[model samples]
Target: MTEPTSRSAPADQTQKEGSVVMQLMKHGKEVGVPSNELSSANAAADQKGQPTLEIRKDYMYRSTGRPEKTDMIKSLLTDQDASRNCELYLSASSNCSAVESSEDSEEDMYRDAEEIEREKILLCETSSSEHKVSVAPETDIMEYCRKEWRGSTPVAIRMRKGYEAVAQKFASIRRVRGDNYCALRATLFQALSQTTQLPSWLRSEDFTMLPENLLSKYDWIKQWQLKHRLGRKMGEISDEIKEYLMLLRKKWKNISEIKGPVEKQEACDKLFKNEEEEYSLYEALKFLMLNTAIELYNDDKDGRRVPVFSWLLFARDTSSNPCQLMHNHLNHIGHSGGLEQVEMFLLAYALQHTIQVYRLYKYSTDEFITLYPNDPEEDWPVVTLITEDDRHYNIPVRMCQETVL
Candidate 1:
């Protein structure tokens, strides 16, 4: 080819063109285009025309520091009127760069704000919602005293007065008893001797008159003796006490056998009635049933066979309609096999207690059954006993065994 000339073009044009091509090559690398292909295209365009007059890549612009070369190319390619078009490329590049910088700043600001908001949310979630309060013992005592006497009903007023008297008597007895059973027993014996006929010397006359100051000591004994003798002989009993005991007995009997929603509601009502104000009779029954159920379950493990019918009796008391107590008992028993067995243990005692309760107060078992829908097969009296032999009893025995071992 005519001694392929190494002398190329003007240094400024060459440098300007080379810089633009190199920038294009760098951008090509960033966009994953072949750098070699771009270099070949640029070389071909340079060789085809006067170096200053050549048009290379379309994106090359004056703002990129190639103003003289770009202006020359634009003048050669178009009429004099086209000179204005050259500024368009310069302005577009400036605008694009500005937009990119602004977007980057906005993105950074958003990230920072999000991080702060996330930290604030984390702090809120970890903090406790309620403030802690420390209550003094004297404040609690005063509150209790206030609650005990706030109501002015005849029964409430009487109960408050009785409690005050009982508290005073209890304090005096505590002093005399001095927490010694032997001393109490001696005191009781001496009082017993004085209350009965005996020789002065032989009967220990020092125990004379049975000390009126010790009247508090004899309260329980006097009450018990009075109930045993006067209650049985005269057949006179306090209606309120009898009602309370009857309700308790019914609750003990009916818990496991309480099968339906209506009965459960009734039972729950009886147990929790006025629960906000005072110790409910239902609560006492529930406590007693829970204890009895646990005891029965333990006894069942020792091979003591208790009748299922007896449990039904215990669970079927109607005095105050103990369906709720029975329901709770059954719920615990069904979930805990140990509890179920304890319930079984209490069956006989519960049945006997139920009979006594029913004798004192009349209640309808049919009414209870009506409230509690009986299971099919007429197995109304039978409590379902889930034993180790039951295939459906899937509780892992190994875990319990491991604990025991």
Candidate 2:
């Protein structure tokens, strides 16, 4: 909001990434993955030289699925009326909604504030060595949750002097396993957890194939899609996607349909065994998230719009690609990026009042810094904690790590 500070990606790097579906449609080509795109992804493209779904133009859009651009323009009743809400979008299609939205309510205010539009994907290295990357114990990330940045020590004194107010407001630090994707997984975990309440409309349908544990995840995806009008932007889904979605529905319902957990897992494995579908699902998920970001960033009312910082986010490197980051894959070196400490929190959190993160960098001289800060009255709740080692892994080296499309 305050010119986005240095935390934001630079203007040139923040160029809009068009439609997520259209961009991914490019990879659907037979030419294979391009090198420039590879630089930002962790290991989404597999060692087998295959993408999740070899998307084709025909599958990207259906003539009957939705109207063409001309028809859409002609159908509009009034050009003077530009205001549109989520329901309006769910009922009708509109590309104009990608970067526009109305004023935020309390919940949306929280959501909008963090929707600092960005998309720079990155992945972390997962090696068999089992050598932990830092000296700090995993549990140490929790210390700063309750501890104030205080004391006579220089770093502590500086934190207290500069950020005591916002630093003290954070609830608690959340620690997710570093085995892989602590950033994305943890963020999704919180988002899914917060979205646990099932809408009554969703309960009427039979999703007997999904595992009981995953029904909520599926529903949350649907709920989020409609709530954000993403379904409309995507137009009518293809029969193949619909079939795949149904297959997934059946597979997930199988969790409850089957008698035992072991049998259930086996059934689930059978469903997900297809590497192609697995990759397709991953890409599909990223596009859905991309849609959410674009829609929220475009939200406008009375000609005023809250700008998101960038769709992609990274600790030090500004040029990361989120689409590549979300996919899980192992490289020739057997290193998997699926479970690394990528800055996945960006996926869950969006433009908001102010969310500050604090790291206890035991390894550095200026060990403590106010990563995010805001007035409580003006901003939503804030802050997350990490160890010095955690910060090290989050920095620039992994951006240069070996892994190509």
**Winning candidate number (TM-score):** 2
Residues 275-390, model 1: lDDT tens digits: 22112232223333433443343333444432332222232121011333344233222122112211222332322211100000011211111111111112112211111110
Please report how far candidate 1 places residue 147 from its true position, in Å. 4.8
Cα lDDT of model 2 by residue, 127-153, tens digit: 333233311112222244224332344
Q: List the global CA lDDT of all models.
A: 0.26, 0.27
Question: Model 2, clash count?
Answer: 46
- Stretches off by above 4 angstroms in model 1 are 1-143, 169-313, 317-327, 330-405
Worst 10 residues of 1 by lDDT: 354-363
TM-score of each: 0.16, 0.29
**Count of residue pairs whose backbone atoms collide, per candidate:** 15, 46
Per lDDT, the best of the predicted structures is: 2
